[model samples]
Target: MFELSGQDVGEAQLLVDGSRLEALRGTRTCARWRWSPGFQAGETEFELRLPDGRTRRARIVTDADTRKLTRDDFDAMVRDILEDTFALFSLSPFRRAVSRGAGGPVPPIARLEFLRTRIGELEQVVARIRRAPRRRLRAEEAVLPWHKARHATGTEIVRSFRSGRVLRENHQPPRLPVQLRGHLPELIRVRRRTDTFDLPEHREMAACLRSWRDWLRAVSGRLSAASLPGSDGAAWAARLQALALRVERMRQEEPFAALPDAPATLTITSLFRNDPTYRDFHRLWRDMNLGIASVFGDFLAMPLSRTFELYELWCYLRLARAVADRWGVEGDGVSSLFGVDGAGLTIASSSLVLSAGGGWRLAFQPRYAEFWTRGDGRGSYSRPMTPDIALWRQVDGVPTPLVVLDAKYRVDQGLADALTSTHTYRDAIVDTKGGVVNSAVAEAYLLTPHQPAAGGQFETLPMPDRLFAPDYHRAFRFGALTLRPGMQAIEVAASLDAIASGLES
Candidate 1:
């Protein structure tokens, strides 16, 4: 599978060194190797050229088990990767202490937290409504029998269809007795009411909670709808069922009935009327909508495998921890370095600044978007240039050198592209008001899954011992480092140790 020959059992010529060797179905030979084609990793198929101008298709398999993948394994890997990603930054030192909750996995607990938090907020609103049902004292005019009036004014006349008699009269032209038939403002107590609900907030809150509850039920019901994969399949299904039951209970305790037949405009301002409770209601509404959209709607359908795009995210998080540790910081210190930015799990373009003392700081930008490069020298962007990870720091608001790291999910045939792109990344120059400065892309690295050392062709790329030389004037180049997906954390830490130590020295 690692050769570039065309013949089934016979010999063929190599592309790189032009040597001849036997081509086997499941084995590799040095004479049949061509380093020029480069190595491709992961689940990709490529064709190898033959001396007779024919091509043979081959697939590169990295996982030991190439059989059908199970849903449980997929879910577990997703959860593991995401958990590691979130651990890169804690919300606050006392977030868990104060809120009785820590960060959660992107898909499962995080999504659940969103639901729980929104529900709690809605509950508070319900409490407020129950405490002070919105009401108003209004006025209306009506002709009533004078006896019903507690204190009626003078009446100008009282008639019995024959003759009129003054029940009470006053010398003042406008001042009549209590028996007067003149119109008067009657104060009426009007309690705000919808169907069984009073305020529009009540109706909207009920509708929102009902929708969320329905969504939860639907999701939970899906557990029995199909057979799930993984060892935790039954357990996960049970958990879902339990959550559904809880939601059912919550809905049963629903404070407000369904919305009225007539529509009501439920504005936060009208609901709380500048009351502090307005914040709670608005925040809950926003969170409920966003949580549903981001978690269940967006993230639920994502697949977990070597092919997932989040592989880069996982890599960046692990690398961040490794880099911090390599800088002589561990545990809380490492956590603080990245958390200084206060942004949480920004997958593509996350920026962080670490104060390293002595007027020095270390800044990192993962999936750095502002890194622009001109690949073909045409005075225009020949191709898009965004390094998977970029590291740099400024002292006293002035720009310094930068280091760019790229995560290559597969590096066999893609290794050449990674190398070429990384070099172009090296040439990226940034202009500042102080002056136009070369980004001084000091070092560039291509991180990929570890192929066995027996396959030596991938490791031949040039890497300097001193990646971040104190001199900072050396020409830039990329080094190929291997990572193990099965043991992601260990491999990532090991790779960063090698890369960061070189850079720091």
Candidate 2:
């Protein structure tokens, strides 16, 4: 993945092999693609087609990591990044179109594949049923004639008929023909019969069980070639295959699904919720679910798009950590001040705010203050001031904006391009009350993925003596922090420490 800053100067665009791709927001050397109409912070993946009929993975956002992470940790990191990034769009002002919809149902195949965890439960149920083969004895009623009665002090008709036969025959009653069937009652009584299989419930259950086995087999075959991490997965698949085979054999002669319930009755959550062996399967399914996003064959790729928002979130979280670490105040009650509002997930300000005790607060993409520019004594206006991260400390029981930081996705040149904007942001944004004007922010800084070009040096802005002390201006006050992969935490913390010290003066 690569990062390019962009601008909408009416004609700014990039051409890849003469195919027109308009820049979302700068020059060809430093521009973000016009992925949508407005500023979008996420990353998008595309296949970089080569002349040799091969394609390589590429992304629109910068890839921050230099090393490969373990699967579980990697998965967790992905989720954390998404959650933190998505949290920004939940800001009250910017809340638009963001939805927490991960809890919804997955596709049937994916669900079935995920259910590999319940194999243990299925096995247990199958073994228990096989051991006893649940059969019931039912009482059936029947009528018998006198000739068929052996131990019958039968009904009056049968007794009278037998006596008449005794008179008509050679002075003796006819002996009953002993042709009684299995478990037949004597002389018109109820018969107890053992019923096995052939029950309606049993047939339905059997069919459902067979369908489940078939589904498992189909899913296993579909994912057979996937090189997912975990040797145990292979063993699990093998076991499932064996189980399917056993199920097939059981279906040949007996109803495996007939043991009280249908296979459809056993869902992944319902049946495997308590099974210890199913935990890994759940994780595996989650992993698989990430691969497919929609019917257009789009996939969720690593270094996932939307790095801008992710970076903003990282800055907020890192700043919170830094403040908590330095001030010994527990950063608590982290939450989105608002929710995603309406269609297309558009955020109003995309601020992620956290409450730090002792009258301290951390915010991301906060649009609380505004800046205005007066040109030649004429009443001129500027756009609203929106900072990526703002740290507020209470002074005289009033929250004062201390340090404001901007998350820039550009490299060194792009960061350079944003220097003028930084000066404007720091100087123009002000607090006004009763015709009295004051600078709302004490200091401003830039956060970026590129390493500092001047070896951790900052650029000093020359300010009027009346506005700020000369000495304060000489220390290269406003600068950018190089946010690399391995050292983000340390870099952010160190930057925050400097910001804190700068605010102290």
Candidate 3:
């Protein structure tokens, strides 16, 4: 059962999915309702209808509590996945285009989110720099009298002798004429070592902070001008303004305040290479230049409702990388994975196709409709089916499905339930040629984030050691692979190799 509550009910009825609950109980100031069967682990809608024929609606997101992932952990996982995906695009043949920002128009929302995250990182870097900024002992020439000329350099002494300013046994002041004996009658120029914060690296950092603040202001203006559907532009602009103010405040702080303007060309110094804070600052500076708009389109708005979808995309990308490593990507194969649109650089999520050397191909979210009835002569026997990833091997120009993988953003028992879809895909999807029916897919597998326990009681479950056995895979031609975040490259490659071994000749 589920309970819904709200304030100022005032004779209003509660509805779940447009159905009024008969067990509603409430007063004019408060209301409550109980519904049977409870809610699922995803997004749901709730509405309250007033007597004045007005209705208020809200979307409630329910996370899968069984996973026990904290908010920070989830955020870190998502960030890692996105950064990895972006790295792939950068390393591809289109690296030049990505570097030049020539992919397409960047969305204002993407820019706003990008700026916000980078600004936060910059703040952290600045905090570290403020704690222990780079400094050096600077020598300066100063005019001082006898008692204060303890650090008088040899050059200053020679200059004083040559100028006839140093008098023996005279105590006259530096600027006053003395008729009697005085020691060092005139002021002597001395060289003193003092700590200074004026360095090229510090100047560059200060300038970077200022530039980021100005960039934030410019982006805020652009966002205000652009019309965003279902978004409050004023609120976003206000938030950006606050961030800009923070950057400005940082610029006016201690170490940064003493630095001069950065040079037109900043030269890399030893401090940048040796100091931890400087190294971190330099890395963040370089990373901020690489815009996410050129690779990810509107991905900044990932809410709890779309966590599963995000996980699916992450799994496909990870598998795609593994496939590339295993078979070696062919020429220009990576270019087909991205496209340019009005919003920004768009990933070919639904219909991406890639080719590897030696007659190997991969597809993301490709549809297998009832193509047997069509002239093309391919697809499923019943209805359409779209799998997250499909691996193929071309034999004499005829494509054969080598492996089918579906990403399930689930763990534990949910992963077991997802195995049923792989079974359906492997069975219903077939190839018919010359009135002969044959199974089109050689093997089907589910990719999940579930990590099975090591020698535990749950070993009797489907995800135990038996599921990963080579004999079980060869006999059944179906299993699930654990491809969760934080997995090393070698582990992912091993999973891909297992899938490759399932090829039926």
Candidate 4:
């Protein structure tokens, strides 16, 4: 059984001896099936490759207990979902997940005051020893301190307070991330949950929870991609995940009637229209702390994931637009490339950027669409790709420099920053590896954003009217910069140009 999920653009596969089995559809949601493979159980191998790049494998032994089912059952169940079943639709990866504005600089998870208190206790001992007094005694006094109370004995008279020191207690680093501990209890608890199918309530709650988990995971993957921008993007991803987990935890705790039936008549429209009646209706939603209905309820009724997905698309589009506006990559053309699901951004960056600048070729592990079935580059892309943005050089003899670049967006970056935050890192280029490490880059026009001139790979030289403004050089304003949004295109061209110059040098 192979479950094909993701934006309907990409596909997921399950293989048993490198072949597809179609009978697993019934178990897609809950694969509570007993397997008795004819091949001496140990001889048969089972493997699952999730939509994400994570893969798991196991083999069955014919002699072992036949009742137990591992992830293969789950994988087969998921594979069966491709049967075109259920009220399926793209749940946007960009939906205003949880209110990201709640927590301030304080980690929202747990407080660490106890550990701080222990460190303070150890410091007191050290302070007392340093303040100890030393008084010398007369040699004629009794040898032992017990013999002389009034007269000082040599041994009892006085001594420096520096005999020894004891080791101080040091606490272990907390496992709780600045924001993850709160969700940890709930997320871990649901892992081995049993389905009380016999109960009407557990059945409904479990179903909803499972769907919610898959939906959250998909969107989470999108934000962590190269183009989208957000503060603490990864942290927010976790927080959103925490939100999903909370939903499941709610279901797990009560299993049924998790939310009091405040209002059976749900109207998504009221949220957008400022309807006072709808706003006051659902206390369950309010109790759960989801105020978003007031702002986006109308959109929620329409498949929350798809709207969120579009938001992510918009974010990338905005980013690409900024890049284009910055570098004037139009002459280069913008074509999309879809690469392996978990392959680094270099794959797509290599595919699209190189072709924009002409003959500077770039190759990548092809895909129908890397991020999702609906992101800008979806299934519309060609796999085992031909030149995505085929190039033809402007100058006849200028040899193009064929360079490949990658976009690195760390997950935690989302955890710490906001969507519009600047892209600067305090890290200096102390460890410059091979290649010319630039601490700064400047063009005639605007300076790069959030970084010094030396923004790597992403920096676009200030292009004149072609991109920025008509009188580009005259309007040049230097300042802190990050990689040029449009630099991928220019980089393709500049790298080739640099190669040409190097050849002539």
Candidate 5:
């Protein structure tokens, strides 16, 4: 994966390798690309030969930013990564060659030979798994769940400052110290260095990298030997450590190897709501948010490109929800896209689709919330496509947006064909998961509530509007960026209209 950043300033037209590749954003900015289909052929190279004489280059191989997972969790992650990265082959590696030598130059006979070789190489990687060892974390890495530290220390607001707190950064203006004015550009340079990274990550990395390259070279030394130049990452780390130690030792022995240093500050907010002992947990946010970032930002490097967004899901959702709430002018109340009975109107859809993915369960409160009420919130009426809406804390005390969508509901093929569109404005999606996939039904409905808060009575008159009017930024702001609630058969279509209202800032 490579993030191609270049500005064709003063150019009248676009050009790639002296020939046209694709147009840029109004003015030329930057682009990102992944080595397409036949990745094995180009495994040893990053440069691409466009039609013209010049060349496009390989930049990076980024792993989607991952959380600090438990041993079992990390193992699962590794398995998934391996499956995705190596699954071009058949269930058995016999048919994996075609996807490998894709862009490589070779005749049919040679391609066949390459495929055979790749199969052997894969077997070496998997079969060479002599043992299932415990995965470990290093000093610089930490995926501390925001909630965990908050719970452990009983501090909802934990702040870390490098030197001072007032000089912190925010979406608003960042305060730079007068002492650091001379090094601002250097600091930015340091930050950019972490971008194009696909290297060793631990103490044993250098040796392992060396072994890996040597092994690959020895195995395919003739046809294609994959040489990893920056391979022994562990060794590189060791080298840097050695140099630092030497400096430190010299400083101790002779007191003047140190130079004057300027200081910067880092202040971070632990939590917004001061909920005590509420351990922040995550099984899905990292992947889901990251994948969404990849969608429009860079289709080719979805996983790699969106890693940062995974860590920033909170910000993204906050912005997205704000945009969604302000799209339409009128209407409010808990509304379901599946049906009007806000409680009976369930969020009937798969657990993985963008429209329905991400868990929507809140503190299971029924006294104030309508989704959990006895008589289905769909108001005494029910339809085939009507979703199951679990009335939640919809009262003034616990006012916030919610669309309770229980995904495990078992229904017939005709029923499941209804609720499957993230495009809240249009309801053209039909469920592809029939009974064959899973007959179990989840007892919740996707909410298309007019406002972030679930309940607001509209003009209590004729059936012109079905739900309560939602509060807005003028009154209360919903916490995240999300598609608004809408109906399906009785799909409320005004849920996500604010997405285009410039939410990215």
Candidate 6:
């Protein structure tokens, strides 16, 4: 909620994000307006319209509570959750699409930063591998003159004796073969130790390096295709081209050139396990294979203004974890959370459904449309309502919405306003049969970072002790749950358990 007042303005209207705000009181020159920014964070624009046809503009920077979680902490949490989500998506059909540039437009700053850092590390590793590549003494067969042959095995000598050719060159002094009176051959087959870099491990390393170079080139091409003139993306694409060129050059040099393609079956040697260079190479190669960073590059590019959306996603994942903890996930439940579309692979943000044991299922942003006149089903009595998270239970072959949780990235007074939606959700959403209407949702709650006694207007609603009390949920199905970043899994589970207990009552 925000308040704006201007001098010498008889009657003024306040607009936030281009939407006019209703004044709470005192409209002339000192009107107080209430507006909930919701999850929007960053610079917010405010425009005030005066009665005299004059306009005043102000920009205010809004941010989350630093005491709860900093921006860096928020970004890290988002990355971690996205990594987990990508891991789950890898098992679904969308994995192939994700590999084929499904991540949409490359985010300039985050993509460039990732490429820069990873390429730097790869350069160092390639240099080290080049300096000391794995090699072995391979026995090589060669035909040499008798005088030059240092060691010849009996089998080789016999083979050379059978296939030996006489040297026609005239020497000042007779060579060893001529002096031996035809017992020694002029040319002999010899076996010598030679350092060869054709080991299976080296082949595997070469394959990994080639894969990296190709992936970098592909990403660079994508950036170039989407880049505009003099844009940051164009600059990033240039930088990526340079990095890709460097990798290509490194891959073409020395041991990599001598190595064959990676075999269908390659053994993992002890050197790969213990050697520093080999271990680093293996680890980095595995990380690149996962494609967690590249596949979800758009996530890291998200702006702070969309922090609320990120928070909502994080909340859903955390809630799913809590639900899984309470009741084990059903078969392939985790993999079912993702779906593939023309946009590539993405979490089913609008209509994801996850099943668990005990006939429980969790849904993400399922809509309850108006179906009041229709027979027995779940829907809203008035307008369509969609909650961020909904918990359902299968009862008599029907999926019944038991709890609805709306994640609001607001605290204190903003949270209080958010709670009003819960009231509407609990009352308007209903189960109808033959024109009979009853509440479809047992409990509806606003999930926020608001803690009791945190010094805000929330004190007027409920204190910490009473708000979190299990009995409180039973008495009032509509309330608020404190869920913020950095909360332990156990703590989140406990908070969710409170909701379950309320439903049981």
Q: Return the TM-score for each candidate structure.
A: 0.38, 0.40, 0.73, 0.21, 0.19, 0.54
Q: Mark the 10 consecutive residues where model 1 has the least summed lDDT.
A: 97-106
Q: Write the per-residue lDDT of candidate 4 for residues 1-505, one digit (tens) a residue.
A: 2344344313344544333334344333332222434212223456565555776776544442232222222212122221101101111122222221222222111111111122233234323322431122323312222212334322322231123222222335654334333222211111122333233322433454344444445444553452235344454454455545654444444323343333222345533136333233232222222221111111112221122222222222333333333334433244333221221111122333323232333223122232124332212222222211111233364422221111212122221232222112111111122334332112211122122232222234342112222222224311111222223434534433422332222
Stretches off by above 4 angstroms in model 2 are 1-306, 324-332, 337-349, 368-381, 453-476
The residue ranges of model 5 lying beyond 4 angstroms of the native Cα positions read: 1-20, 23-205, 208-375, 378-474, 477-505
lDDT of each: 0.44, 0.45, 0.66, 0.28, 0.25, 0.66
Model 3 regions lying over 4 Å from their true place: 1-96, 99-125, 145-159, 162-164, 168-185, 227-235, 263-287, 290-293, 298-301, 341-344, 374-376, 455-474
Which stretches of model 6 miss by more than 4 angstroms? 1-117, 124-132, 150-183, 249-258, 261-280, 292-343, 355-358, 366-388, 397-505
Cα distance off (Å), candidate 4, residue 373: 41
Off by over 4 Å in 1: 1-80, 97-218, 222-301, 326-384, 395-399, 429-437, 452-476, 488-491, 502-505
lDDT of 5 by residue, 1-505 (tens): 3344455422333222122234344334545443332112212213444323454554333232122212222222222322222221112213212221112321122112222233333333322221221133333322243323322221212232222222233323445444443222211101111221121221122232223233223323322323344333322233233333432332222111222321111112232123121111111112211211111111122222222222122112222232223322112211211121211111212111111112122221112222223232321111123222221222333222333332211122212232442122112112122212211121123232112333345334222122223323213221122222111211112333222221212
Clashes of each: 13, 21, 6, 49, 61, 0
How do the candidates rank by TM-score, highest first?
Answer: 3, 6, 2, 1, 4, 5
lDDT (tens digit, per residue) of candidate 3 on 206-308: 8877776776676567665673642556546656777889989998986889677884223578888888888888876755554333555434345433456
TM-score of candidate 1 on Cα atoms, chains taken together: 0.38
- Candidate 6 lDDT, tens digit per residue, 1-505? 5555567553677876445677775755666778665433444567778777877888887674533334544544564465556645543444354543425545334334434555666778878988988788998788898778777765676677677565554555655455344466678988788998887787777776676666667767887788786465665566667777887787788777866788422356898788999888776565444442434433345544456666777787777777776887777776667655554555554667768777788888887788754455668878999888888777667766569898887765556556678788888888875557788888888787666553333334464434544455656766678887777878988887876774444
Q: TM-score of model 3 relative to the true fold? A: 0.73
- Which candidate number would show the highest TM-score if scored against the true structure? 3
In candidate 6, which residue pairs clash?
A: none
TM-score of decoy 6: 0.54
